[model samples]
Structures are given as C-alpha cells and as structure tokens.
Target: SIEGYGIHGNSAEWSIGTSASLGCFRLHNKDIQKLFSLVPVGTPVQIVYQTVRGGIDLNNNTAWLEVYPDIYQWSNPELESAKVIQSLGWIYEPHWQALGNLLQAKKPLRVEIPRVIKIEGESLDIDGFYWQQQVYLSQKCLEVLTVNFKTLRADELFSGFVKLDTTDLPGGNSQYFWDPQANTLRIIRLKVLLNGMELSDAASWSSDHRLLMNIKTIAAQLNAKFDWDCVSKAAICNEMKLVGEPRDGVFWVELEGLQRVWPQLKSTWDGKNYTLELMYKKR
Candidate 1:
C-alpha cells in the first residue's frame, strides 16, 4: 500500500475537484464519514481519470459534454472529446469550427444537437443520451424496451454493440453489435474483460453510467508490469516512466504509457486536431 495518500475529509471545498491536494482525495467531512462506515476494510479501490466528462443535464434531460483543462498537457482535448463521443456510438459530424472557437475563447459554452433514437429499425419517440459507451434512456423508453421487447432490463440496457472476445464470457456465447449510423444500442449480453480475463465484478459504476476499472488489474491482465515509486511519485510500467500525482492514495498516470504496450493504438495529428484509432490484427 502507498503511504501518505488516502481519501479523507478536507475543509477546502473550493479545491475539491481541482488538483490541489497533496496526495489524497478529499471529500466533505459528512460524506467521508458516511463512506467510511459503509465500505469494508481491505476493499480494492481504483481511480480512473478522463479529461472529457459526459452526462445528461438532469434539468433538461439533454446530453452534454465537458472538456476539462489539460493541466498535465498530456492529451489533446478535441481528440479526447471526439473519442468520448465515438465511444457513445454516436455518428454525427462534429462542429469543428464552433468547437475550435470555444476552445480558443476559453469560455463556458453549451451546444445542443438534435438527436433521434432509432432501435431495431423502429424509431422511438424518446429522448436519450450516450455516455461512456452506454445509453441513458428516459423512464418511458426504459419501460417500453423492457416491457415490450422482453429482452433488456432496466439494468441490462446498454449500447447495442460491444467489441470483446466471447471466450471471456460465461457459457462462451454472446452477441453484441455497435452501429453508430444505425442508432442502436442494446446490450444483449455483456462481460467486461482485459486480455481475456474477466473483470466484470471488480468494475465500478459511476453516477453518470461510466464503468471504472482498476489500472493495476488492467496492467497485470495485459502482461505488463506496474509499479509506483513512492519517493518520486512516478508510475513505471514496462520501462515507460510517467510522473504521477496522488488522488486518494493512488497514483494517476497519463495515457501515453498505453501506446507503449498496445502497439495497435495509433494517434496522428494533421496540423489541426489529433485523431486516435485502435487497430486490430486479423486472426
């Protein structure tokens, strides 16, 4: 276990979400008290960081995306935003000019898109938004999909298409498809994995419907060695070194190291914005 790091109460509410802590994640006193009592000892904890946060605006029930400052200068915000949108199985031409303007002006901005939900060739008159590759449907849509189809439950509904090795799943049989142009996200079956090892049980669900996985577990499953240098606060994996910052006692590293181990991951910059793509080898 790492020393000088943990999740605890902090009086600095203004610095709650910012990178202002020494190493540990800070929660409100009341919140931390409640969390401490509910969580058992020795429970595994993992922290996942993303520059682009996506969710639905509860008041309006519309989809929204937030681009956080790249304080570490490790990622391209535009590309990260695009990736988040793509992960949601969205197939729409982005407003690059408007996005650029917002980025340049450094102003708080919100843009709404007219979206239609198409499921299995039938368009449903329901409002939904995609976040972290999962679809958040309205109560009406959930009822209709679960009651009429009798295939998806309130908890089982997800993006229609998932890309994974079926051997990793129980019973060794599952069907998943993702078609952004078709506008369909129905999770017939799902099993989260890393390099064919099951990680479904260890995954954590966020309030915004995103799944968070432990990086150490992921590193081990990928056959990569992971270690943290407590003195320097650096994370080392397979000879690649990245300076990490502590959040609730765990070191967080940038995504650059991923490209080192995963050779199929590619990124290209065309003098404007970066494009990231994952290539798979044919069997």
Candidate 2:
C-alpha cells in the first residue's frame, strides 16, 4: 500500500548517499538502470541502516573500525563501536579519549586497536598511550619533573585576578589573571628592564577546576610550529601530528611535542618489552 516510494535515479549525484532524500532510496542513473535490468518488477526490496562498519584485513590480521554519522540520531556511536569491537574478540584496547575526539568530528574514522604500553626505567607514576606512531603522556606527569603547574578553583576567581607560579617561559616571567567582568583569562608577560608589559587573553578554567585550551593555542604561546589539516582534522605540533584528548583529570600530549618545552626530556620505544622508556639527559 506504500505508493510513490521506489528506488529512483537522482540527478543530484552528490545527494545519492546522504540523507537528503524524502523517504526514498536514491542511486545514480547508471546504477539504477543496471539494477532494474537484474531484478524483476515484483521483486521485494529491503533497506537497512548501519552506524558502525567493521572489517578485518586478511593479509595482516588487523581489524578496522569505521564509525559513521548517526544520521537518525537514534544510536550512540561510541557504545555501538565498542559493541562491534567486542564482537570481533580483539584483545587490544582503544584510547577512549583519542576515539572521542575523532568521533566528535563526525567524520568516518578508521582506528586501529591500540596496544598496551608501559613506561620503563622511570619511577614516575604516569600512564601513556600510543596511537599512529605517536606516544601521548599524561599532562600532570610533567609536574613530577619539576615543571610548574597551577590549579585554582572557579569560586576563588570571583575577585577576577590571580598570580601564577614562577616558570621558565618567554621573558623569564609571566602572570595569569582572570577578568570576571569580561569572562576571560589574561596573561601578563614581564621582561627585565622593559618599560611596557604585554597582556593577552588566554585559556579559561573548566567547571571541574581544570584549564581548558586547545593544542593550537598552547603551541602559539610556546612559539612552536603547529599546523592543522582541515580535510583530516589532524592537529600537528612541532611538525608531528598528535592524537589525544582530555580524560580523567588531565589531557595527554605527544611526547615529542613535550620535548620542545624541555629539551632534556627523551622518550624511546622498547619494542622487545612493548614499553616506552622516558628519561632525562644532562645538557
């Protein structure tokens, strides 16, 4: 009894695979003509929608997880993707934060199951994850190496000003203050024997008492080279593409990129133990 609903050829070829049609299946003219020749007039038709598509490469035995958009908005892509991975019985784990960033972009992404990684030869109690040849280390992990880090409660900023700890940034001094009236965080740069200081709005504090800033913003402040590929949604820092996201209480950054800030820090992969070793060398 469903009338005016049939497979049809679309002149707008760009809309063929998208959800732009009005309750009808669309295909290219050549495809529909070929399908018409293969099937009879009374042939029954069935359509299905899938959000997560997965497959394995027989040659290398690596599983590929492809996540599609939730066109109908009826399913959770993250949960659905996990179910698919479980069904495959793969032992490797995926970095949830990195996966979340890729999912947020709303583009189909193929991620390989990440391998378990550990840090050896260092008493530092921090975790790391590996993705696409890059190692992401915990943000708080830097504090253990004498790096200056500060955290302030959102309520404490009602007065609209705060000072940061001394650190080895540009000009040998900096200040972090809040402007509640304007709802912005500003940084003041001070230099020895300089008449004028520079002030600029910087990162904001998150509700959970964490500083929220993107990689590009941090890179710019550190004077490091950064590039972003619009087509792939990849963030590159110091000429290296990084993959990570905020998780738990801190975000992860590429180990190589961190080395730009502390040149003495070094990291190397120990394939034999499947671990990443981090150490500091005297300059």
Candidate 3:
C-alpha cells in the first residue's frame, strides 16, 4: 500500500526530487495518477543510475568529462574506475600530450589567424637607394615584393670579375665561388660585368622562375661568403644564418631571410615597383 496508490484523501500531499519513503518508490500525486492512467497492469519497469558523464561540443571545440559524488553508500572500486574511464573516453592521447607540452612551454594557444598583410609603401628601397627594376607583390613570392637583381646593376655597387666554381649534385651541380684574396665570396651571374667589363654572353637563372638570379649568386657577387649547411638546413652568410630548404629541386629562401641576415640591406615597395638599397654602413 503506497500513499499515492489511490485517489485523493484529506491527508494527501506531494513530495519529489528526493527519497521521501522508507520501503516504497514514491512520486507526486499527479505524476502517480498520470502513470496509472498511461501504464497497464503487469508492465515492466527498469531503473538506471549514473556516477559519471561526458559530452563533446565540436562547434565550440570544447569537451568535458565529470565525475559525481556517490550519493548512495555503494563504493565498489571496479564500478568507480569503470565510470571514470567511460567518462574519459571523449579525450585522446595526442590531445593530452599536446596540451601537456603547451603547458610546459608556458605559451598561450593561438586559434585565430591574420586576415590582412599591410605594406609600408611601394618601391623596394635599401636605405635611400632604390633599384631600377619594378618590385611586384604576390603570395607566390618568398617575400612580399620580388625584384630583378639586374635592377641593382650599377658601377658604384659592383665591379671586377669574381670566379665561380661548380660541382655536380643529384639533380644538378653544386655551384659557388669565393674571392681567393678575401674571406668573403662575391656572387655574380649573367648581365653582371666581370672585371668591370662584360666578359661573356652566358647568364645564370634561379629555379623559382621569379627572382632574376639565385640569391646565392647575388650573395657571392656582394662579397658575402655564402654556403649551404646540410645539418641545419639553412644558408650561412658570414655570421648570419638564413633559413633555407630545397623544394622540388629548387633551394628556397625567403627574401625576409636575406633581409634578416643583411642588416645593411633595405627595401620598400611602391604600388608598382620595388626599391632596394645596400647601405654599407649602419644608419
């Protein structure tokens, strides 16, 4: 005989949300009445209990797993461990490792990316000196603006012949030249006069098909000692190291890498052309 088994009486009352009886399952008077109307006799009843829960919200890129206190006196170790492991199924090992590494490094995680890139001006300039060739901008170029090295051809900047040595590699030959007199190597290519005068009609080109000549060639002509470092996968110029790696048989180095290594080198871009100046002294 349950208190809610029958119709209303003078002492009838309702209690819910917690245990309110000693030996019988109980519900509010209205709930019991509704259940009695909807369920027939001999219907089956099942009960469920939960101690841990988890959920994933991919839209927000977030997830959580929680373990709740056991309200009942039952403290089965196996059951508790199973519930905790079930709740943790939403997390993966790699996610945990990455999170741990970030914590150890003490760097904040970044999710947003830049939307726009702003340039200072048109015409690439070095110091105040500007190149003759027009500078162009594109995502395809290593740096924002790329200009032909021939634009830098001038008697004041470059003169005298510099010898270049060549050696064969897997796809092509490893080629470089350095001045025997100086510790630095002066890079030179086609269109560049040797010994302050034109010597040959042959010219050298770069692999990216954008730059007028390979940077290594220019570096050698500039009297900057340049070499490839296999271990670090970069280019070495005197004391400066430029990040570089070969992509599709073409060794690629960003224009920014060159600028970083050569502090005297200055560049700017006008709307149509690039300006470059090689400042021999610090400004």
How large is the C-alpha RMSD of every model relative to the true structure?
A: 28.1, 19.9, 23.1
Which candidate ranks first by TM-score, i.e. highest? Answer: 2
Q: Write the per-residue lDDT of candidate 1 for residues 179-247, one digit (tens) a residue.
A: 554655433322343433455322322223232333454566566688877689777777777665543
Instruction: Name the regions of candidate 1 deviating beyond 4 angstroms.
Output: 56-62, 105-283
- At residue 272, give the lDDT of candidate 2: 41
Candidate 1, position 236, lDDT = 76
Give every collision pair in model 1. Answer: 25-248, 160-185, 160-186, 161-177, 161-178
Q: State which candidate, 2 or 3, has the greater TM-score.
A: 2
Per-candidate local distance difference test: 0.48, 0.51, 0.37
Order of candidates by lDDT, top first? Answer: 2, 1, 3
lDDT of 3 at 95: 25
Per residue, candidate 2 scores C-alpha lDDT tens digits across 1-283 of 5586788787899997677887888989999999999998768877667788776665654567787778779888888877887788754566565555556657666766443344443355554444444344455444443222343211131122222221222111223333322322334332111012222322223333332334454455456686655545455775666554442333334444456554765555443432334455445
- Of candidates 3 and 1, the better by lDDT: 1
Candidate 3 residue-wise lDDT at 270? 31
